[model samples]
Target: MPTPGFPPHTLDDEGSPIWLDELAAEDPNHTLHVVRGLDPAAALEVLGAKPQWFQACELPDARPDEWTSLPGAALGAEPGSSATLLAGRVGEWTFVYDDFGATDHDSTEALSADGRAAATSMFSINADASLTYAVDGKQLAWINVDDLDLAEDLPGMPAELRAAFTAAGVVEFDYLEPGDPDYAIAMRAACALAGLACTLDDLRRIPLLVTPLG
Candidate 1:
């Protein structure tokens, strides 16, 4: 059995979803652990952090662990000034923002809530790996982890990764966009296939970036 942690193979020899493997290779410092069974507020407290460049905003209805912010005065006229970035908990997962200036400096508009979800690292990494094919919160079909072997014929799958899974006798799962009653089922199945304790319900509540505690 694979150990439940980082360094790729630590999780299992069956191997994690190919995308997850690549993600770990890119940023081994953070491990993606499932978040489950915690109160939303408590989860936020543990997960939320104030974003570095923005001035904080205090909303009347904001939860205790929530941090809402507009571009700070120092950002002055830069794209950050026009944006409102939020970092906090929504439902069961911790919502976080990556550095926008570092990656998306050309944009002229504020980040909308759906944009926030899309901009979040969780969605980005998954999309990059073809784990969940989505953009700006709109999910398209995803590679089925349970049906990887069949996925070799997928139109856009990365060939090297496809060969890797195929060589390993892995079966990739192919799923449609969420909204079908089976979306949750797919998430649950993926988690189990990946040796994760986190549930589909946890994922449905919010898309979150997983960070290693230590």
Candidate 2:
């Protein structure tokens, strides 16, 4: 039990935890036990002032635990071959941005209010196209407007873009033109070019009717 006079780690009025004190009270013996048999260099190296080597390896201070990424990262094996580039997330549940940029997608998007989605990371294609296919650890993807049949032929798309298609099927592209509806028609046309089945209804949902755009 903690001392009655002593207090729990401090919190700000906003309730942020004071982390410094918590570290001091933690069991160093337990820490050593967890890291035992592992290289001391590796353990101390992660938080140290100087670089170190282990087993002839000059390891980088790469934050493997963070949501790191490279721009233009794709969702599949082919990646940039045909697919457009976008932002990416590389943490536990990896996901790639399917060019979900706004101003080009025709509407200002705010994700569903229930907190199910975030607009900064979510988008639907314009009226005529669909993101049909993707590849990654998370496996999020979209079928083209014309490629919906290919979607069925190849594999399943993840839930995000699939949900978007139930409403619209245009992709977000970097080169969204300046004007009304942004780049919708052209973007949708590109998606339609793929010949994938994307929509059954103007609003593609509820027993999604998939006819091959091909």
Per-candidate Cα lDDT values, in order, are: 0.28, 0.22
Model 1: per-residue Cα lDDT over 27-79, one tens digit each: 22111212223332333233332223333333222112112112111122233
Query: Candidate 1: misplaced stretches above 4 Å?
Result: 1-9, 14-113, 116-131, 146-154, 157-214
RMSD of each: 15.9, 23.1
Q: What is the C-alpha lDDT profile of model 2 across 1-214, one tens digit per residue?
A: 1111112333212111222111111211001001112232322222221232212211122212222211112121132133222211212121112221222211111111122222211223223433322222121333343434423523353454444333223223355322212212222222222221122121112211111000
Per-candidate count of clashing residue pairs (backbone under 3 Å): 10, 21
Overlapping backbone residue pairs in candidate 2 total 21
TM-score of candidate 2 versus the correct structure, residues matched by position: 0.18
Cα-based lDDT at residue 86, candidate 1: 26
Candidate 1: pairs in clash: 144-172, 144-173, 144-174, 145-173, 146-171, 147-171, 147-172, 147-173, 148-171, 148-172
Model 2 misplaced stretches (Cα beyond 4 Å): 1-137, 149-156, 169-214
